[model samples]
Target chain A: AQRVTQPEKLLSVFKGAPVELKCNYSYSGSPELFWYVQYSRQRLQLLLRHISRESIKGFTADLNKGETSFHLKKPFAQEEDSAMYYCALSLMDSSYKLIFGSGTRLLVRP
Target chain B: EAGVTQFPSHSVIEKGQTVTLRCDPISGHDNLYWYRRVMGKEIKFLLHFVKESKQDESGMPNNRFLAERTGGTYSTLKVQPAELEDSGVYFCASSLSKAGGSYYNEQFFGPGTRLTVL
Candidate 1:
């Protein structure tokens, strides 16, 4: 079984400040990690994936096996970045069934 | 191309009433998935369909929930005698199949249907 943990329910940051959303996971096998974002009144969309090693909308995440974490980070936060973010983990044993975290609501105040 | 689309964006009904939600996946996508989120809970997988067949349904809550993708184009999830705990948002996602492959493709999601059972 796989489980995702997002400790923070709410995170606030000022515009132009750096931001980070922490995520941790417990899985016995190799894991595929992803970050999903949902804007107000919008559908959930994939932001980034550990397998791709890419960044989207100035946001990037690095998967650390030693730390059992995948933290999303942005050098400078923008008001548009405020949204609900979920961290998910998937194992091949489960046929790519995603186990999502409870989600963290990010607020960027200008 | 258009993204995945779901019908009956919102529905409200009595406890014993049956509700059916629809999902239209992107054209040419062979993999479809269903998920739901209850209040204060994480979004959990309900099932997965590959074309017209159910590939995986280990996450389905119970027999009260039935899903079908008859023609492999669109799918529907019917919840019979819904309980108060069934009130939540149901999301549908579609992705291209990568069968027998190690990597998985990204899934496109619909806006989701919000069901309220009183």
Candidate 2:
């Protein structure tokens, strides 16, 4: 079975402060990781993927195979960044179905 | 290009009543997916469709849930006699390409329908 875990239910940070949302996964085979965010009153959107290694909205997450983790990080938090973030994982063979974490709500206070 | 769209932004129904949620994926996207987030739980995959065909449905919780995509234009998920445990948000997503290779195809999501069962 594949599983994704977002340890924190909520993370509060002041504007311009650095933030990190922790995520861990368990999969026997190769894993595909992704970060998705849902802003207030908006649909959930893809933030970034481990395969791309690209930054979105100043947020980046590296998939560490050694630790079985994929933690999302941002140097500066913006009020607009306040949203629900989910870390997702899927095995290479079953990439069509995404297994998601419980999600962490980031509150960026101005 | 229009993103994925789901009808009935919110629905409230008594237990034992049926509810059907609709989803219209982005134009030209062959892949459509169904996911649900139950109270205090992670967003979980319910199924996947390739055009009008069911691709994978291993995640479906039970037979109470049925999904269909006619003519590959739009899809509908019907829940018969929804239970209190079914109250949560249901999300639909779509992707353009097949799953494989180094390139990761992004799945665009709809606003999602918040379902409340009494």
Candidate 3:
């Protein structure tokens, strides 16, 4: 069974400070990881994916195969970055069926 | 293109009642998915539809939850005799095609319908 774990329930940081949301997964096969964000009154949208190796909204996540971790990070947090972040994992066998982690609520205080 | 859209942004029903949620996928999307997030829980996959056919429903909790995609367009999820545990936000997503390579896996999501069963 594929499972995603997000260790933090809430993370508070000051504006311009670095932010990192920890995520770990347990999967036997190769895993596809993603980060999704949901702002207040907005739909959950894709922020970044490990496969893409690209950053969105200044956020990036690196997938570590050895550690089985895919942590989302940002160099400097902005007030607009405040939102609920969910880490998800998709197995190679499953056709895009994502197993998500309990989200982490990020609060960037101005 | 218009993104995935869900109807009844919010629905409140008492236990034992039935509630139906609708979702309209992107015009040309051939793959659709339904997911839900219970209180303090992670979003979990409920099912997947490829056109009008159910591709995967292994994640469905029970037989009470029935999902259909008629004519390969919009989809509906009906929960009969909704229970207290059914209270959650249901999200719908659509992608171009399941076989269209990895890029096609980028799914656009709906705003979700918040269901509160009292």
Separate DockQ for every predicted complex: 0.79, 0.75, 0.69
lDDT for model 1: 0.94
Clashing pairs for model 3 are none
True contacts kept of each: 0.83, 0.78, 0.67
Off by over 4 Å in 2: B99-102
Quantify all predictions' global Cα lDDT against the true fold: 0.94, 0.92, 0.92
Q: Report the lDDT of model 1 for residue A98.
A: 85
Over the stretch B38-112, how does candidate 2's per-residue lDDT look in tens digits? Answer: 999999999989889998988889999999999997999999989999999999999887755655578899999
lDDT of 3 by residue, B32-113 (tens): 9999999989999999999999989988999999999999999999999899999999999998775634543787899999
Highest DockQ model number: 1
Ranking by DockQ: 1, 2, 3
lDDT of 2 at B106: 85
Instruction: Give one digit per residue, the lDDT tens place, for model 1 in B47-87.
Output: 99989999899989999999999999899999998999999
Best by lDDT: 1
